[model samples]
Target chain A: MRLGRRFVIAVPTLWLLLFFMVPFLVVLKISLAEPRIAIPPYSPLWEWVNGSLKFNINLENYSYMWEDSLYLNAYLSSIKIAAIATLLTLLAGYPMAYYIARSPEPRRSILLLLVVLPFWTSFLLRVYAWIGILKTNGILNAVLLWAGIIDEPLVIMQTDVAVYIGIVYTYLPFLILPLYANLVKLDDTLLEASRDLGASRMSSFFRITLPLSMPGIIAGSMLVFIPVLGEYVIPALLGGPDTLMIGKVLWNEYFSNRDWPVASAVAIVMLVIMMIPIMILRRAQARGAEI
Target chain B: MSEHILAAETKPWVKGTDRPFVRIKGITKMFGDLAAVKDVSLDIYRGELFCLLGGSGCGKSTLLRMLAGFETPTGGAIEIDGQDMTGVPANMRPTNMMFQSYALFPHMSVEKNVAYGLRREGVPKGEAMQRTADMLGLVKLDGFARRKPHQLSGGQQQRVALARALVKQPKLLLLDEPLGALDKKLREETQFELIRIQEELGVTFIVVTHDQEEAMTLSTRIGVMDAGRIVQVGEPREIYETPNSRFVADFIGSVNIFDGEVDVAAPDLMRVNTSEGPVMCEPVAGLTARQKLHIAVRPERIRLSRTPLEAANTMQGVVTEVAYMGNLSVYRVQLPNGQCLKVTAANGLHEDNPITWDETVHIGWSAAACRVLVK
Candidate 1:
């Protein structure tokens, strides 16, 4: 039985080592090498010198990332934007998930389907559609003008606000789905027990419902924050030039600047920065499972 | 008439001077087109362990929820401790419920779950902690206070739920099938523990349960419900011995009911002409001659003997089934009229010479043992 279980686990372990670990090793190796003007665009980690192998590791790429204000600002702004977007998504998704979870069984499935309906269209198409809605002469401005709510067109497109809107809209289902699963599993009688014990509706929600759904909050926040930290398409399509993000900088370096070594360094550093939350999420999930 | 009046008035708790602590007046709860709890009125006195006993979908739980203020009555009013509870929210009500599932907060420790009510009442933290400790000690769960609910055993979790509900010191404590989750042995043990805590705290308790034995053991008075209506409300022994209807008799315990007509309805004694034979029973007032009625006799009340006895209500029957329970032996006696009557005999020192199946037996019961149901 143990051997059969080991065999069952071995397949996925081998696949992950080959597909994920190997690529990560390659990226790490490239990040330690110097950028070149050749086709491959980066120097090899080891080279033949006088018929003997000599290592050519470069620390300049790492130091250059620290020296540049653009890279530092991009990292900080990416973190800030992702954090804000995650918070917004949580604020919007919690009530949606709670309502769906509390709804009658027949309506619950339909509400969940509505949450996931946006995924039927391509993510890029949805982000592109935001452009038509948020632009100065777009649908939102046209509606506001027609309604007499505003006289001037709103300058929302190609701004930080647009990026935030796009991120929240795109990742809302990811947040709501996990939260819904968690909230639906909550025993209704626990809330009643709280109320029965003299807790008002608000206090019961905070003390019982909120604390019980912490695992879901952590899971959902990580789902939104990790992806938004590396979000490229939403910012590229909706954000202005002033809206600096690490994903956009990495894209410019690898694709436009053709600096694969510096881009690899950026990718490695992003991974390191994301490692903290990922570990925290994993620990929380483990603890939740134990409970 | 005098015996009836004495029986009604002699119950010490039902005196004229005693006012009910909780009065539910003509309360009706309707769910869409369905009346889950019909027009029902009941009075429960202070410090009484009252049980709402019924089967599933019989509205006992609905009545308990109405008492907890979780469900509002479509009509009628509730007054607790002389205060109107109409439209009062569950949080605002002076009552707490221990849920059937024991709904202890999974995220909190036992201490926190117990202290949650006091915390919500804005009690001081130190005082709340002290009360929580005292409640845990009352339930004998003091050492397990720091552990989360999932970490405790089922019985321990039930105790925690009890402690949590009781710590608020609410005027009324509602328990919905509190022992339903425990195994048989644990359930029996916890039933007494619950009664002990209830008495010690002097809290008025309204427990809802479908388990008749649980109700019998725990309740000072039981309100038997059926199909959204309360059929009878009395002490457990009164309910068992003098059930108002066949439904109450059957619902509470094993009963042998005989459909019959009143052969004679006199002031002193009445006789029922059943399919088996004519049965003489104690007179029930307002029963007229030749009127259709039913006679309910408990299994334990019927006597089983191998030899015939010259008794007023005696029948010769062959024992078809003999179940040798450790404490008692149940015999299914099939009379010549094709009716089967259940009789339970105490299995004392005569275990070796037990009554076997197919043995002809004489079954009899005193006239006082039989309940004459007019409905």
Candidate 2:
């Protein structure tokens, strides 16, 4: 019995140690080091000098990030974009989740399957496909132009709007799945009780269903917000030159400038910035369990 | 407000002077081809605690749901307080329901839950707060107003649900298995608490439960349903003592029933020839001499002794098994013809007079004690 219990506990511990803790420690060590023109491109933490041990820890990377306004602007812009994208996803996904949750048996399963069906394709390919549909000469513009809806080709191909579309389209399932799970577990009698207590349908939704589904909302928002904060691909591919994100800046520092230390510093700061919402999501989940 | 809408007197059902507070006329609900509630009609008077009693899936809950407007009747009309309820949504209706699961809002405090309806009605904050506090006090949850539903025990949550439902002062209060979630001890106590509150408030209540004992203790009138139809509806004593059908007699309590045909029918008595022997039953109106029927008798009414007593019905049987309860002892006596019967005898305080197992004994009852069920 003891051996079996230990084995069950050891599996997840070992998995996290190997995959998560080690990689994070590596990044932390690199963030504290100085850039060098070498194979690994960063100075080691310690070196043998004058037959004794000597330390070479650099705080210059972090100070450089603080001195420049580029990093601060990128972080703020990323938060703004991520917050707006999350709001849009919520507005679109809540109704879909409620519809699926309220739908009767086989139809409910079919709707849930449709929500997750887009995930079967490659994420990158799906984002790339958004480009094909949203560009100036793409299907959307062609159809709108043919229908006399627009006299000129709308410049929506390379913009923040296109980026929002890509993020919501890609991460929609994340929001819907959790919200559906939460809404499905919500007892129908609670809604009935609300209605029976003289609440209008809209009032019932706002009072009962919305408050009960807060855990799902916070969880999905954190899942989308943290990833979209340091997201490099969608903004880099679809956003114009004015669109500056921390992930793109980090990438440019690592590959173009060969500055692994500064890149690691930027990555660490992004992680710190994302931790606040993730902690909030965790507290919400804890409270949900109590409920 | 609800009192103004209600008619006068507590036992209005007995006088038959005022119109029924709730009139369900031929209400039927169908789920595809199967009918959950098929043409059920009943009248509930003001200040009456009526119970819809049935086994599971017998449509008692469905009938209550229809009254609450949770499920619209497919082919009938309901008139509550002299107004037609067709096309009236659950929110618009002047009825509130206490669900079996209690359905307390897990996110809100007890005070907030009780105040929710009044807030929706746009009551002033001070008035709503006063009413909410009064309701919480009525349900004996005055100190736990700020606690959420999960923070309290099951019984406390149930009280919160009741306070929330009653704070609206609805014309009709529908409860679906209110005590089904509680344990035996709490259920018995809550049953009387429920009665006290109903009588004090003088509101018409329709409670749905499968427990016959609960129905007997809580309701002024009980409607026994079977197969999506109400088989019988009457006062508790009337339903128990003079059931019109075999289903109601068997469903209500422990009963020993014997199938038989009427050999002779007289004004005061009827002789039934059963597989065991000829049994005596009370004469029921419209029962023919040769009509096939069943003789039903309660166990406590039957007498068991070493010698036969002077009664209209008597049978000789051997006591096969005996179960000694504290107050009463149950005897499983088998007749010579291979039929077993349950007979219970209360243990007298200073008596050692119980026929042992495997002994020849006689069971007899008066003709009036056994009912004659034709169908």
Indicate the residue-level lDDT of A152 in model 2.
88
lDDT of 1 by residue, A1-291 (tens): 999999999999999999999999999999999999997999999999999999998988899999999899999999999999999999999999999999999999998989999989998889889999999999999999999999899999989999999999999999999999999999999888888888889888998899889999999999999999999999999999999999999999999999999999999999999998999999999988976
Residues B265-339, candidate 1: write the lDDT tens digits.
877778899999899999988777889989998999899888887666899999999898889989999999999
Per-candidate alpha-carbon RMSD to the true structure: 2.6, 3.4
Best by DockQ: 2
In candidate 2, stretches whose alpha carbon ends up further than 4 angstroms from where it belongs are B1-11
Against the hidden true structure, what lDDT does model 2 obtain?
A: 0.90
Interface RMSD of each: 0.7, 0.6
DockQ value for model 1: 0.85
Model 1 preserves the real interface contacts to a fraction of 0.93
Residue clash pairs of candidate 2:
none
Model 2 C-alpha lDDT per residue in residues B1-375, reported as the tens digit of each score: 666446334457666888988999999999999999999889988778999999999999989998888898889999999999999999999899999998988999989989999999999999999999999989998889899888999999899989889998988999999999999999999999999999888888999999999999999999999999999999999899989899999999889899999899878778889999899877877878778998899988999999878899888999999998999999999988988889999888877666898999988999888888877
Cα deviation at B225, candidate 1, in Å, is 0.6
Lowest-sum lDDT 10-residue window in model 1 chain A = A191-200
**How many clashes show up per model?**
0, 0
